[model samples]
Target: MLYINQQKSALQASTLADLAEQLALPTQGVALVLNRQLLPRALWAQTPLSTEQDHHIEIFQLVAGG
Candidate 1:
């Protein structure tokens, strides 16, 4: 099971990119924090989530306003 923003998500995804796709989270204005660490966009496709344990994925949205 994957824990996203402290909420459990049943969406099946191995990588951050996949997770974003499944959750409908925009990759352009979002930042991912996996396992309490910042995840680089370059590594999102390569980084794998562990199935043996619950993984924490925090999504931070960046908004622009004037």
Candidate 2:
């Protein structure tokens, strides 16, 4: 199982892009971090996610403020 935003998740994803799709993440104004490292958007499609190990993925959405 992997953790998304500190919550445990059983969802299986082959790549970062897959995860984003599963979560219905927006194409813009979002950031993803894997194992404490910032993941570039360009690499999401190729980045592989393993189900055998415990991984932590953090997703942050940019919010507009006044």
Candidate 3:
């Protein structure tokens, strides 16, 4: 049982893409950082996340371009 902090959803997912799907957020609009490392958007679908391991994930919503 992993504990994801500061996250709205309670679903236990291994990847950001799964989390996004559970949270109903677009994968392209959010930025995720794990353990202080910035995860590239291209790797979101494959990057594994662990809440029990004390991962620091920073999520930012991207604004549409003008």
Q: Pick the candidate with the highest lDDT.
A: 2
Compute the lDDT for candidate 2.
Answer: 0.92
Q: Where's the lowest-lDDT run of ten residues in candidate 1?
A: 18-27
State which candidate has the highest TM-score: 2
TM-score-best of 2 and 3: 2
lDDT of candidate 3 over 1-66, digit per residue (tens): 333445544567888777667767664667666666777778778987776565555667778999
Tens digits of per-residue lDDT for model 2, 1-66:
789999999899999999999999999989999999888888999999977788899999878999
Clashes of 1: 0
Taking the candidates one at a time, how many backbone clashes does each contain? 0, 0, 0
Q: List where candidate 1 sits over 4 angstroms from the true fold.
A: 63-66
Candidate 2 off by > 4 Å: 63-66
Superposition TM-score, candidate 3 onto the true structure: 0.60
Q: What is the lDDT of residue 24 in candidate 3?
A: 76
User: How well is each residue in 11-58 modelled by candidate 1, as lDDT tens digits?
Assistant: 878878788778887658788999999977888889888688889889
Error of 2 at 58 (Å): 0.5
Q: TM-score of every model?
A: 0.83, 0.88, 0.60
> Model 2: clashing residue pairs?
none
